[model samples]
Target chain A: MDRQLVFELPNDLGCIEGAVEFVLLRCEFCEEVSRRLRFNFRVSLAEALANAMLYGNGGDPAKRVRVEVTVESSALQARITDQGSGFDPDRVPDPTAPEQLHRPCGRGIFLMRQLMDEVHYNDQGNAVTLVLRFQDTEALLREASA
Target chain B: MAFQVSREGDVLVVDVDGQLIVGNRQELKTRVLEELEKGEQKFLVDFSSTGYIDSSGLGVLVSLSKKIREQGGELRLSSLNEDLRTLFELTKLDSLFRIHDSREEGLQGF
Candidate 1:
């Protein structure tokens, strides 16, 4: 089975938790995605949404963030678009670097890349797509049965 | 998210409940700084009841860790659930901060 969700949320941090919960609940109904996978996806989605709201839209309530989520038997994907002039993802500093470790910012993009199977950004950088593929679903089902 | 603070000798233990995401991360940072301003140095954040944390939450933790260290103090964490534990490990933050199996162990170190 395949499912999809689309949301246009304001640039408000208060809405992030509810959006994350909605994604996780949607994942629960998809059997092909395991519990562990759902948890990981939740984390990645949260980071992406935060980036769109805080960095992309600068938390402007007038601006909006658009999210599209698709869940299939073999994969899950989310595309987030923000209404601000985009910046280059390449300029983000590596949080793991010794010098950058203490900084409180710049970890969101890194985490989105780390947790998701694939992360892509548009040229303008205002939009990002996150993908997670599930290979060998039969094996996963068997393991769950065991 | 909500935070509860208690003191064990010189260490201030913060028990966090609910999701640690963007909106509430600043509160966590501000509270920690407030404690720092009070000259309370040794810090332990208990995540037993915390179900979720994003990069913003991790950033706050890193910031608090650095702020505490700059003040000649230390920050420790305890009781992270499996997901958060893996997050810390994936980010290699496990190497940056001291993580304990329990609050007692964290307190013992300070």
Candidate 2:
């Protein structure tokens, strides 16, 4: 396991570009870990970052969001920590039910859960860690390269 | 995201591509509303090329539909992927907008 790459960004749209930059950088790092697994990591990372920028900060523009990416064993993990109080992960509305599909919020967390292998939040709810593990046995050989 | 606009008889079709997120919310809203305000209320937003979308993206769609309806016009979405369809279902937004499995169907519905 390598030392993690950490980035702290303001909870505002102005720092969004910077967050994306860090996301791409982490994607490149993940790619190097497994040349065969080019899993749309950048997209997933963006989803996570967006959640931190939006809900994690609780609309407090004065706060900041921190993202840490690391490669541990065979998994690539990106953890995002917000400066404000966190919400219950289970409280996030499920986007699969026919009754709740039109709302503007809650979709980012859904997408992140779908794209990543594992999504877990800290006890205090202020931090979340998303882990992506490259499936071995060549199952991702074609899809990863694509 | 990038959008392509074309006219199908009286209906205007807009093809949207790329991921729809908070970053492009304003831009997407402006472009789609601009077309709707131009008297092209019978519109179909083709999402065949759209790969992913978040809540902010969904907001743009909801707001656009509301804006068009206020002017006595309508907006429709077509060719949503499974992920996006699931998203629409989760947010309960599917009921608010007319969705078609294909662009041809969406056009014919208008």
Candidate 3:
């Protein structure tokens, strides 16, 4: 099965939950798949949206955020685009570093990457795409990847 | 977002009851900082009722922990679900913050 959802939102943190819930309620998955998807997708989405609103839009209420969700049999993808000048994701310091642990500002992108199977930032840096495959196949593909 | 603040022994326990995301993450900080302003220390945040949290929420916790520590106080977290625990571990904040399996355990030192 293939499903797609698109949500255009104001550059507001309050709107994030509606976008997440609307798309999640529409996804039909088994119990295991659902559990993993709920945890991984929800966290990644929230982080992405916060980045879009805070950094990309600079917390400007006039700007907007566009989110697209695509659910295919093998994988799921969410793209969040904001209306602002993009930034260099590489410039973001590692929050996990010993010295940076006390800094509270830079962990959003790192969490998105860790939770999602693939995290890609657009060349402009204003948009990010998060991908998660349905089956990590830890019970099967461990040998292959390793 | 609602926070249940109470005193148990000398520790101030806050029961956070909502998804701590970008929107309401500040409420937690404001309330805790207020308590800090009032000279209340030894805080334990119980998350048994919290359903979701993002990086912003994590940032608030880190900042609060630092603030409390600077004030000669402590911020302890308890009752995080498996996903949240993994989140803390992945960010390496599990090393920075003292986390307990339950509220009782979190209150042990305080």
**Candidate with maximal lDDT:** 3
Q: For candidate 2, lDDT tens digit of each residue in B1-110?
A: 37778889899888887766687778878887777667777889899998767667787887788788888999999999876787677556777889999999999948
Sort order, DockQ high to low: 3, 1, 2
- Model 3 clashing residue pairs (backbone): none
Tens digit per residue, CA lDDT, model 2, A32-130 = 434322323454666666777777786688888888888666777788888877788888767656555544455667766766778888988888888
State candidate 1's DockQ: 0.80
Q: How far does residue A58 in candidate 3 sit from its true spot (Å)?
A: 1.0
Candidate 3 Cα misplacement greater than 4 A, ranges: A30-32, A137-146
DockQ of each: 0.80, 0.42, 0.89
lDDT of 2 at A59: 62
Better of 1 and 3 by DockQ: 3
Using Cα atoms with residue i matched to residue i, what is each candidate's TM-score against the true structure?
0.92, 0.73, 0.93
Worst 10 residues of 1 chain B by lDDT: B18-27
Docking outcome class, model 3: high
- Model 3's C-alpha root-mean-square deviation from the true structure amounts to 2.5
Error of 2 at B11 (Å): 1.8
lDDT of 3 by residue, B16-80 (tens): 89788788878999999999999998999999998887888899999999999999999999999
Q: Candidate 1, overall lDDT?
A: 0.85
Model 2 misplaced stretches (Cα beyond 4 Å)? A1-3, A29-40, A136-146, B1-6, B17-19, B34-39, B47-52, B62-74, B78-109
